[model samples]
Target chain A: MIRLERKFASLKENSKKALVAYLVAGDPDISTTLELMHQFVLSGVDIIELGVPFTDPIAEGPIIQAAHDRALQANTSLDMIFSLVEEFRSKDSETPVILMGYINTFLANSKALESIHERGTDAVLIVDVPGESSLEDIGIQNKNIASISLISPTTDNDRIQKICMSSSGFIYYVTLRGVTGASNLNEDEIQKNILNIRNSTNLPVLAGFGIKTASDARALSQISDGVVIGSVLVEMIQELSEKKDYKKIYNYLNEISAAINP
Target chain B: MDNLRDLPNSDGFFGNYGGKFVPETLMFALKELEDTYDQLKSDPDFLKQIDQDLCHFVGRPSPLYFADRLTKHYDGPNIWLKREDLNHTGAHKINNTVGQILLAKAMGKKRIIAETGAGQHGVATATVAARLGLECHIYMGAADVQRQSLNVYRIKLLGAEVHAVDSGTATLKDALNEAMRDWVTNIDDTYYIIGSVTGPHPYPMIVRDFNSIVGRELRDQSIEHFNAFPEAIIACVGGGSNAMGIFYPFVSDPEVQLIGVEAAGSGIETGKHAAPLNDGHPGILHGAKSYLMQDENGQVIDTHSVSAGLDYPGVGPEHSNLKDSGRAIYLAVNDKEALDAFHMVTRLEGIMPALETAHAFAALDHLSGKFNKKDNIVINVSGRGDKDINTVATMDGISLD
Candidate 1:
C-alpha cells in the first residue's frame, strides 16, 4: 500500500481527521518551500499536498494562479520539486507527500512516475486528467505511488462509482462547482455526496475547494474523512513570505490543525 | 482514412492524442455532448436542417476562385482561393457556430458560452445565439479585448455579455480557462461552443464534422474547375479548425498534399511564435493531447503572432496525429513573411484576407517552383481582413481613423 493508505489507516485507528495543507513547491523560491514543508509537518499537518506550479491552472482562482506564477517566476521545475521532496523525505518520512499539478507537467517528464517514487512521493493528483484515463494508460502505474482521482458535485452516480473503483488514494471531493478559492460551500450537499461515494469504495473521501475557515473545516470533517485546505493556506504563504515572517504561517497552520483535530 | 474517420475509440483519444483532460465536473457535460452529437449526426432530418442552414443562412459553396494575379506572381503552380472569407459574419467561424448553435438548441440548452481570441468566434457564436434567441456569454482575454476592440463591440452589439478574463497571460488560453470554469458552474443549461478543432473528444470530432464542408466543396469545385483534384491544399492552423476542415476530405487522397501553415512571430528561433507543430512537442493543453508550446517543466509558454487568433500555445490533437502520421505537412511563416503575403493578396486579388489566412498565402513563397505548371494549389481564405485592418495599418506606421 502507498503512504496515503497507511496514513489514512493510522488516522482511522486514532479516530483523528486528516489535516492536509497545500503549498506551491517553488513559491517565492525552492528553499522557502523546503522550509515550509518541514514547518507544515511540525505544525501537525497530517498530509502535505505539494503543488507543482503550472502555467495554466484553470481550476484555480486568482490567488492560486498568482502563487503558480510566482513559483514559475522563481524558476521552479518538476525536477526541482522532486529534489525538494527527496530532501524533505530524508528528514521526515512519516508525512505523506502528494504532488498535485496539471497533467502536462507529468507527461513532459519521461521518468515522471519512476522519479516520483524515487523521490519518495506518496501520491499524485492530476487536476485535469479525469477518471476515464488511468495511470496505466499512460504507461506509468507500477511506481508504487497512488494515483488519486477527484469526485465533484457534478459527477453522476455511475461516474462516481467508476471513479471510486479506479481511484487508489483518497478521493478528493470538490466542495463546490466553482474553481479553487471560490466560496459558497454547502455542508449538506457535501455530506450527501460523501455518503454516496463511501457506499462505492472503502477509501477515504476528503473534501477540498473553498474550505476557508476553521469552522468550515470542522463542519466538513463532521461529514467526511477530512478537509483539504488550499487557497487559504496558499494566500497566507504569499502574505507571510512578503513580510519574511515564517512564524505566522506555522501559527496559522497550528490553529487550523487544532480546530480540525479537536 | 476510412477507418481513421472512426477515431477517438470511445475513450476520446486520437492515437495517443485528444483525450478528455478536464476536471471531473465537466466530464458529464462532455459525455452528454458526445451522446447528443452521435445521435444527431445520423439523423436525416437534422442533417437536412444543417444543410439548409449552410446553404441559406451561412451561404455554402463559397466560391473556388482562381487567383490569377497571385498565380502570375508565383509563376509556378496555378493558385486557387477557397473563399471561406465570404461566409456570413465574414469568416469560416460561422460554419461551426451555426452547427453548434443548432445542436445546443436541439439539446434544450437555454444558454450559450464561448471563448474568443480575436473575437471572430465570439461574434459568430453571439450572432447565432441571438438568432436562436438564447442567452449568450462570451469570455475574452482582457488583453485580447483591448487589442480587438472592434470585435469586442461586435460581440456586445449582438446582445451577448462579454467577460474580460484578466489572468494567465490575458490571452486566448486564459479566456478558455474562464469559459471552462463558467461551464463547470452552469453545465445544466449552458452549452459551450469551442471555437476550434481542439478540446476534449467529440468536440474535435463535432467541430471537424461541422467545418468539413470546406473540403467537401473543394473536392467538387476542384473537379469542376481543373477536371482533377488540386495537387495541394493549404490552410492556416491555430487550433486547426480551418486546416482540419480543408484536410479531412483530402486525407484519403494520396495524390493531394495537405499543408498546414502556422504563425512564426518574429521567428521560431526567437522562441516567440505560435507554431506548435513546428517547434513544440506532444503534450496536453486546452483539454486535448496535442503539440504545445511549453517549457521543459510542461508549463505552457505564452505564444506570439501578428494575428491574435493564431496566438495560442497548443494545436488541435488531430493535427498532431496527422503530423506524426506523415499525412500532412506543417510549416511556419514569420510575421514579416505573412504580412508581406497579406499585402500582396489584397493588392493582387482585390480581396483582403485575415492575418491568420495570410500565413497560408505566405507558405507559397516557401514552396517557390516546387509544383509543376499544371499543378493547382488551393488555399483556404479562412476569414476577411476587416477585423485586422487597424492592426495592419498600425504595423505599417499608418493611422487608421
Candidate 2:
C-alpha cells in the first residue's frame, strides 16, 4: 500500500476524519509554496494536494484560475513541482502528497510519471480525464503513485461501479454540479451519492468542491471519509500574498482541520 | 479506406485519438448522447426528418459554381466552389446545429448550450433553438464577443442568452471550457451542441455525419457536372468540422485527394499561427487527443488568426489521425494570403467569401503549378463574408460608417 492508503487506514482506525488541504505550487512563488506545504502539515493536514498549475484549468472557478495564472507567471514546470515534493518528503515522509492538474500537463512531459514516482508522489488527480480511462492508457498504471478518480452526483450507478473498480487511493466525490468554488451544495443529494459509491467500493471517499467554511467541512465529513478544501485555501493564499503572511494561512487551515477532526 | 465507416472503434477512439476526457459529472450525459446518436443515425424516420430539414430549412444542395476567373488567374485546374456559404444563417454551421437540435428534441432535452468563437456557430445554434422553441444559451469569449459584435447581436436577436466568458486566454478554447462547465452543471435538462468535430467520442462522429452532406452532394454534383470525381477536395480546418464534413465521403475514394487549409496568422515561423497540424504535437485538449499548440509543460499556447473560427490551438482528432495516416494533405495559409484571396474572389467571381473559406481559396495560389488544366478541384466555401465586412474594413483602414 502507498502513503495515501496507509494514511486513510490510520484515519479510519482512529475514527478521525482526514484533513486534506490543497495549494497550487508556485502560486505566489515556488519558495512560498514550499513554505506552505510544511505549514499545511503543521496545521494538521493529513493529505496535501499540490496543484500542478496548467494554462487552462477548465474545472476550476475564477479564484483557482487566477491562482493558476500567477503560478504560470512564476514559471512552475512539472520538474519544479516534483522538486518541491522531494523537498517536502525530506522533512515529512509520512504525509501523503497528491499532485492534481489537467492531463496534458502530465502527458506532455515524457518523464512525468517516472519523476513523480521518484519524488514520492503518493497520488495524482487529473481533473479532465474521466474514470472511464485507465491508468495504463495514461501511461501510469505500473507506477508507485495512485491514480485518483472523481465521482459526481450525475455519475450513474453502472459508471460508478466501473470508476470505483478502476480507481486507487480514494474516490473524490465532487459535491456540486458546478466547477470548484461554486457555492451551491445540496448536502442530501451528496449524501445519497456517497452512500451509493460506498456500497460499490471499500476505497475511502473524500468530498471536495465548494467546501468553504469549517461548518461546510464538518457537514461534508458526515457523508464521507474526508473533505478537501481548495478554492477557500486558494482564495486565502491570494489574499495573503500581498502581506506574505504564512501565519494567516496556518491559522485558517488549523480551523478547518479542527472542524473536520472535532 | 474500407474501414472508414467503422472508425472511432467501440470506445470512441479514432486510432489513438478522441475519447471521453471530461469530468465524471458529464460522463452520463455523454453516454446518453452516444447511445441516442447510435440509435437515431440509422433510424430511417430520423434520417428522413433531418433530410427534409436540410432540404427545405437549411437549403441543401447549395450550388457548385465554377470559378472561371480564379481558374484563369491560376492558369491551373478548373476550380469549383461548393457553396456551403448559401446555407441558412450564412454558413455551414447550420448543418450540424440543425441535426443536433433534432437530436436534442428527440432526447427530450428542453435546454440547449453552445460555444462560439466567430459567432457563426452561436448564431446557427440560436436560430435552430428559436425554431424548435428550446431555451438557448451561448458562451462566447469576451474578446470574441467584442470583435464579432455583429454575430453576437445576431445570436441575441435570435433570443439566445449570450454569456461573455473572461477566463484563460479569453478565446474559443476558454469559451469551450465555460460551455462544458455549464453542461456539467445542467446535464439533466441541457443538450450541448458542440459546433466543431473536436469534442469527445460521439461528437466528432455525429458532427461529421451531419456535415457530410456537403461531400455527398458534391459527389453527385461532380459526376453530373464533370462526368468524373474532382481530382482534389479542399476545405478550411477550424476544429475541422467543415473539412471533415466534406472530407469523410472522399476518404474511401483513393483516386481523389483531400487537402485541409489551416490559418497561419502572420506566419508559422512567427509562432503566432493556429496551424496545429503543421506545428503541433499530439496531445489531449478539449476532450480529444489531437495536434495541439502547447508548451513543453503542456499548457495550451495562445493562437492567432484573421478568422476567429480558426484561432484555436488544437485541431479535430480525426484530422490528426488523417494527417498521421498520410491520407490528407494539410497546409497553412497566412493572413495576407487569405485576405488577398478574400478580395480576389470578391472582385473575380462576385462572391464575398467568409474569412475562414478564404483560406481554402488562398491554397489555390500555393497549388498554382501542381495541377493539370483539366483536373477539377472543389473548394468548400463554408460561409459568406457579410459578418466579416467590419473586420475586413478595419484591416484595410477603411472606417465602416
Please give the fraction of native interface contacts (Cα pairs under 8 Å between A and B) kept by each candidate: 0.85, 0.83
Candidate 1: list runs displaced more than 4 Å. Answer: none
What is the DockQ score, from 0 to 1, of model 1?
0.79
Per-candidate Cα lDDT values, in order, are 0.90, 0.90
After TM-score superposition, what is the CA distance of residue B326 in candidate 1 from its true location, in Å? 1.3
The pairs that clash in candidate 2 are none
- Residue B295 displacement (Å), model 1: 1.8
DockQ (CA atoms), all models: 0.79, 0.81
Give the DockQ (C-alpha) for candidate 2.
0.81
| Pairs clashing within candidate 1 | none
iRMSD per prediction, in order:
1.0, 1.1
> Which digits, one per residue and each the tens of the lDDT, describe model 1 over residues B1-401?
56566676788777878988898888988988998998998999999998999999999889999999899988899999999999999899999999999889889999999999989999999999999889999999998898889999999999999999998888999999989988887778999999999988889988988999999999999999999999999999999999999999888888999999999998999999999999998888879999999988788999999998999999999899888888899999999998999999999999999999999999999998689998999999999999988889888999867
Angstrom error of the Cα, residue B123, model 2: value is 0.5
Candidate 2 chain B, poorest ten consecutive residues by summed lDDT: B1-10
Candidate 2 structure quality by residue, lDDT tens digits, B1-401? 76765687877888878887888788888889989998998999999999999999999979999999988888889999999999999999999999999899999999999999999999999999999999999999998998899999999999999999998878899999899989877888999999999988889989998999999999999999999999999999989999999999989898889999999999999999999999988888888889999988888899999899999999889898888888899999999999999999999999999999999999988887788999999999999999999999999989989
**What global local distance difference test value does model 2 have?**
0.90
